[model samples]
Target: MRRALLAITGLAAGTTAMVVLKGSPGAAPVAQDLPAERPTVVPAPAGPTPSGGDTAGTPQPADSTASPRPGRTATRAPTSRPSATTRAPSAPRTTTKPPPAPTTRTVTGPVVENEYGNVQVQITLSGTRIVDVVALELPEETAQSDQRSEQVDGRYSGSSGLVVQRQSADVDTVSGATATSTSYKRSLQAAIDRAN
Candidate 1:
């Protein structure tokens, strides 16, 4: 903004000076007749102009349109400005992703036994929330026990099961697997406690 302001001020000053100098008596001969449109012709600013500018045949500066009586003419060199400064590109920055999600891990509980058989629970956790549960061991001694165990596992274990949804062992027992369910809860609660 400052540079632009300075440039405008310089241009205005230069134009005013040129008009005063060119129109002043002794600079040129007075015209016997005036033209229709007095168009002001201004040159490239206080900047570089092409070399060999003045034609060898003409006495006046190339800017003048009239054939003026030959006299002394003066010229000054344009001022040069320093180019804008620039910095070299710096090394690429190293960016790192946030340490992976604290990672979900499975924690096993101490074995808990009941009349049915020994029960052990494994819970997969992320932070403090239970994400999944698995009954590592359940009674499979008899056909009835196997069926009952499956009922207990289906209701309380797996990713979308009661243990994970409730995020705790406080779940309703399966109809035919009371003892197995109770054992499962005890083991799951212990596993959760260890995780925390």
Candidate 2:
């Protein structure tokens, strides 16, 4: 029995030794006919020649994983992009204003006669404001022979500023013509009121 056990032990040791000698159990194995991990060197794709590009070109496969052919334009590569500062600028808002008022000028006489036909008056207006009043060209019947031709008569009884600014008008002498002068004064007042 010992002899048989010894024989079994010897056989097991011999098998282990054989495996080690074959470079598998104890040492790293040597791969037979194994391929190397070299990088794939595929070519670029072909395209139409641009205005100034070279004419010689080769076509490539459409699959993205396939390498591009030599002398081919790369369609998938990124070209140009815009910077952050070149967008359109914004504008400010604005407002407008209104127009001004109108101005006026002076107007003068349409000479008029009064009742009993002895006195006359003329008026001047400065834009609806009475500026002058005058008694002019009186009749001989209401005037005295001794009174000067240049003398003013019928008393300035209207707006003092308006009457004083006027050129004095001659007085007419119509005997018992006091009502005529009173009428003349009333007419002058009417003209001034109209202007106002």
Candidate 3:
């Protein structure tokens, strides 16, 4: 029983030593990345030929021993013929797509710090004409105290109402806010441009 136990222990130790020497735990084989072995093609051994590899230099006699057989015939030489040439049709033709329409609109205003707050303009355009115009976020205090009122007459230069004339214009600006009024007027002009 003692000998049998010794033998089993020795076998386990040997197996563990082999595994460590082979580096099998998460270690790749040394020759795994090398290119695969392939068969080498060797050219056949050739002997020297007569006539110096050229049959045209020296013409052999008809009845000479070096001549070919009587029945077999040599192949004919290759020939070259005229190739066909095609010409495209001559015509003034063009196929092009039209440019896309502009879909974005923008409005500009001034930066004015009034007694109430900052001032900015609001403009609304419909197509090429000014459809709507308004002051952006007016102060509640100014609206109550100003009491601005005006009557403006508009006339078209031509038969179409493309142009207009303001007969009477009344405007009310903040106590120290002329810039705010200018910004509002700029917004109105932007709206008019949208209308045209």
Best by lDDT: 1
Which ten-residue region of model 2 has the weakest summed lDDT? 145-154
lDDT values of the candidates?
0.80, 0.50, 0.43
Off by over 4 Å in 2: 1-116, 142-154, 157-177
Q: How much is 183 displaced in model 2, in angstroms?
A: 2.0
Per-residue lDDT of model 2, residues 1-196, tens digit only: 9999999999999998987788665666675642333323345545543556563454333455655546443345455777677776676666555644333433333344544354456676544545555565454543552242123343452446325445332334334545555555555655555455
* lDDT at position 174, candidate 1: 91
Distance from true location, Cα of 28 in model 1, Å: 24
- Candidate 1 structure quality by residue, lDDT tens digits, 1-196: 9999999999999999988767865566666653423333334345444468764433323454454334423233456866567556799999998877767788999898888789999999887788888889999999999999999999888999988888878899899788999899989988888988
User: What clash pairs does model 1 have?
Assistant: none
Across 81-136, the per-residue lDDT of candidate 3 in tens digits comes to 55566556689888887866634444434434556445444444434443333355
Worst 10 contiguous positions by lDDT, candidate 1: 68-77
Enumerate clash totals for all models, in the order shown: 0, 13, 8
